[model samples]
Target: MIIGIVKEIKSSEYRVAATPGAVTELVRNGHEVIVEHDAGTGSGFTDEMYEAAGAIVADEAERVWTSVDMIYKVKEIFPEEFKYLREGLIIFTYIHSNAHLDQTKALMESKCISIAYEDISDDKGQWPLLSPMSELAGKGGFLAALHFSQTINGGTGKLLANVCGVETPVITIIGCGNAGLGACELAAAFGNRVNVLDINHDAMMDAKKRLPQNVTFMFSNRENLVECMKTSDVIINCVLWPKTRKDHLIYREDLKLMKKGAMIIDVACDEGGAIETCRSTTHTDPIYFVDGVMHYCVDNIPSAFAQTASATLSNATLPFALAIANKGVKQALKDDKHLRRGLTTFDGKLTLLETAKKLNLPYTSADEIVSTF
Candidate 1:
């Protein structure tokens, strides 16, 4: 099979779909890897690196897009690249279809086999492709919030960590998942008064036992959340429900309840922001004010540290790419149920129930889709 590694064109997207080492692995396994020129530059990788790894560098995206049976990418195809889609050309990437109606419509209309990385679940019920980036975003979210918490940045001027005579800022987290856990880790590391709230009793219990005494764990509810928000210097929003629009837990009026000049980090911006005031921002201009509260919601936080993010993301996805390349999607998915869950769309039909319901499209049962394979 011929694989195409296309350059990512999303705004501020810096990670590449495949690194040179990844290309070498595919080449050694009797697969032909065609990478677009300068595809890996954002990750500090060059064309020479790919050439040395036995990959053919194509000057044109058209050449890469049309010639390959499947096109692998870091981010989903942006509007500029949408014209390259052809029927049966498989797209494997982080397609946050629930949030972007236009992209979802394009994928469905194109009749391509669209495999979303976020929908693919492991036996432990975790997202494989989306995890690395989420970890990066979670850590970045804290820094973004910290920036906004400074007086010059329109914040209340409360330091996350206290001095000898000063009080520490309170960091309130709304979820206990990967992003939430990451925020908690950073906030606690910075010596802030951290409060992690989650609806999952098990997660909250685990957090209570694992974290330091300064890090508080609480059950998530309207009363608790409202009180926490009222006093919080920084609030990190990580709540998410995969394959559906995010529930805006913080309403427009909720920002008023928060302390003036408080900062918010909505890590779920790509899914949908957790805060009503949260709108997607870029690294170049990443903060805004709403009702005296500062919001930092950059959808692609990993882009800020491309080199580290690229390697980590590529390493996590390499095994799955190899599996599908060597065994083909049908056989590989049949053998591994985790890979099977990755199939968002196949054979001109939407196969994921949540995605179909969110998109208002007809649903194809997972069992039925797997049976076809």
Candidate 2:
């Protein structure tokens, strides 16, 4: 199998899908790895590193995109790359199909096979590919709050950390998942009063065991959330909103309930999904004001920490990529039920139920699609 590693073209996206070591692994497994020039530069891996790892370095992205059986990338396919879509090409990346209707259409019309990293599940029903990035995003979201809280950055002028003579800042984190726990860990370390809310009692209890005394676990509900909104200096949303759900966890009007100059860091930057005010900001313009409340909802927060993010993300997705490369996409998906969950599109059909329901498109089960092929 010929695999291509293309540089991420998304705005402010710095992480690469594969690292030099990952390329070496592929090369050792008898798979040809092609990397576009400077593909790993943003992640601190030079072109020479890839070349030394036995990867063919292509001068042009088109060459990499056109020559490969599978294109490995960090982000979803953007408009500029849409023209490169071809039948039988495997797009292995974080295809947020439900969020990008145009991209979904492009993939279906092109009849390419796309496996979404974010949708793939593990044996324990955890998103293995998405977890590493989610953890980074969680920490990055908290770091963003700390920076945005300074008065110089159009913030409320409240310090996130505890001061000698001042009161500790209160941070409210929604959900106790990987992202939320990551946020809570950092926020509590800063000596802030951290409140983690989740609907699952087991999850909350599990988090309570690891967190510090300053962190409190609360049951997520309208009343508790509203109370937290009124008192918390920062609110971090880590809930993975369902794509087909029409309702939002935090409504536009709910922003008014927050204190003036308070901010929201949405780790799960689902546009109109979790927070009504969130509309996927970029690293260039990461913050916006809505009803006196500031919002930081960069969809690719892990990109800010390129080197660490690239290595961790590469490690998480490499095993699955190896499986597909070794056994072929069909046999790999057939053998690993968890990997089949990542199948967003196969042979021009939308195999992801959430995306189909969200976009009003016809749905085909991945199992059914693979059986027919």
Candidate 3:
């Protein structure tokens, strides 16, 4: 099977879907890899590296997209690439179909087999493909707060770290998942007082065992949330909001409860999902003031650390990609229920129930579709 790796074209997106090492693995597995020219440049892998790994270097993205049996990518398909969608083409990527209605429509209309990396789960019920990037996003989110908190960056001018002969800064993190733990690790290491809130007692206890003394675990209730807003210098939200939920955890009106010059770093970045005021931003313009409180909600925080992000993400996703390539999409889906869970569209039908319900489209179960084959 031919696997295509295309350069990410999203704004400020520097991470490539595959690295030279990943291409080498594909080549070793007896699969042909077509990498677009400079596809790995942003991630510090040159075309010569890909060639050294036995991948064919295509001068144009069109060539790679057209020639490959499957397109392996990092971001969702943009409108410009919508024209490339065709029958039986397999798109294996982070296809957030629920978030992008038009992209879902295009994938269904084109009769492509679209698998979402974010929706794929392991036996432990964790999103294996999404976890690596989520951790990076969490750490990067805190770093963004540290940078934007400086007065020079139009922030409150208060340093995020603890200082001698001064009160320690407070960092509040919502959720105790991979992203939250990543943010908490960094925030606590900086000697700042960190508060992690979640409704899951088990998760909080686990986080407590791993975190330092300065970190506090609290139940994620309205009272605790309000208290955190008022006291925290930086609030990092790591919760993944459901697509069907219309209500927000932090409402726009609640911004007034925050301290003046305080900032929110939304690692989740679900527009109108978790935080009412959060709209996806780019690295070029990552922050804005809402009710005098700063908001840093860059949708792709991990992209800023392209090299590390690419390496971790590639390692986590390569095994699954190889499975599909080796066994073909149908057999792979039939064999692995976890992989089938990620199927968004198959043969022009919507296989992901969440996306169908959110978009008011027809729904087809993965079992039903796979059984037919």
Could you give candidate 2's per-residue lDDT for residues 1-373 as a string of tens digits? Answer: 9999999999999999999999999999999999999999999999999999999999999999999999999999999999999999999999999889999999999999999999999888789988888889999999999999998998878999989999889999998898998899999999999999999999999888898999989999999999999999999999998887779889998888888788999999888887988888999999998888899999999999999999999999999999999999989989988989999988789999988988899999999987875
Backbone clashes in model 1, listed as residue pairs: none
Quantify all predictions' global Cα lDDT against the true fold. 0.82, 0.93, 0.94
lDDT of 3 at 122: 95
Candidate 3 residue lDDT tens string, 19-138: 899999999999999999999999899999999999999999999999999999999999999999999999999999998999999999999999999999999999999999999999
What is every candidate's alpha-carbon RMSD to the true fold?
2.0, 0.8, 0.7
lDDT of 1 by residue, 1-373 (tens): 8999988887778889888888899999999999999899988999999999999999999999989988988887788878887787788888877667677778777888888887788878888788888878888898888777788877667777856788778999989887888778888988999999899999888777777788888888999999999999888988874545556678888888988677788887743445767788887788877777778888889888898888888888888888888988777777887777877667667777776787788877656877866
What residue pairs clash in candidate 2, if any at all?
A: none
The segments of candidate 2 whose C-alpha lies over 4 angstroms from its true place after superposition are none
User: Regarding TM-score, does 1 or 2 come out ahead?
Assistant: 2
Cα displacement (Å) at residue 279, model 1: 2.7
